[model samples]
Target: MYVQIDLDGPAGTLRVSGHGLPTVELLRSPGAAPDPLVPLGTRDPARLTLTVDGAPARIRPAKGRLSRRSYRVDAIVSGTRYRLVPCSYGESRLTRDGRPLGTLESTGDGRVDADWAPGATPLDQALGTALAAAFGTGAQPWWQTAADLAAELIP
Candidate 1:
């Protein structure tokens, strides 16, 4: 399966194309699963105009074979970043400028909790931990903590 994810950013745009999507439930729907793709471009996903202040944003994928829940997305409401993960029962971690910042782990009932590094957080820790803790899931994304997470991890 193949999918295309486009994220709008400030100044320009961020685009990612790849083989699959993240297993985080934040992307899924109440009863759907969508296959996500990682953009092979030299940059991370694009940042959109959607923010905490803007209206709800939209994510358009190439296909819908995956669960609808897998395609669920939410804007941070403040920054130019938007989150795409399983919605009903998944978790997600975030990185800033390619650095791990924090994570959002799902509690399995459509309520994902967050846990970022006091300073420097890991990109794929919360998602990995949530999946493991919930369903013994196994799939690692190149996660790393950004300077913020690193600050917490080291300092």
Candidate 2:
């Protein structure tokens, strides 16, 4: 199944909609601060929450080192763990318990395309797509890019 995530919704909102799935609205928030001891370079572990059919789920940065080139975000829906691992490109893979659930690709036009596996459930479709949209699928902010460049040059 295919779904499209619209990032151009009202500020701090992401809309996920497509065939075979109900429209879901994810609310974005800068939840809590990352652990000071953990090394997250130029990456903000923002939090996202969404409710689908009265079931609420939360997505947040997993505990680990998040750098400019790689990062991991996680969401739990109906007791199933979904992880989104994004690469440098405008692409990300959605995994469930280490198994591939789907793929999300950014079109660089304020939208993301999500292709789901054959066995994915409706909740899986909604949550996975929302996670990818909330995590973002584009180049880093200019300030962050510049800071990373400066850090590399200083060493």
Clashes of each: 52, 0
Candidate 1 on 42-153: residue-level lDDT in tens?
A: 1111321221112333333222123433333433322334333432333454443345455555432322345555653222332333232222111222132134446677
Which stretches of candidate 2 lie above 4 Å from their native place? Answer: 1-4, 29-47, 62-70, 138-155
TM-score of 1: 0.28
**TM-score on alpha carbons, each prediction:** 0.28, 0.64
Model 1 has an lDDT value of 0.31
Q: Candidate 1 — worst ten consecutive residues by lDDT sum?
A: 39-48
In terms of lDDT, the poorest run of 10 residues in model 2 is 34-43
Q: Against the unseen true structure, what C-alpha lDDT does each candidate score?
A: 0.31, 0.61
Candidate 1: residue 34 Cα off by (Å): 12
Question: For model 1, what is the alpha-carbon lDDT of residue 143?
Answer: 32
Kindly list the per-residue Cα lDDT of model 2 for residues 1-155, writing each as its tens digit.
57766664334556777788867776645444433322221134344466665577655665433353345777666677778776545667788878898778754344557777888778677767766655555334445767887899995
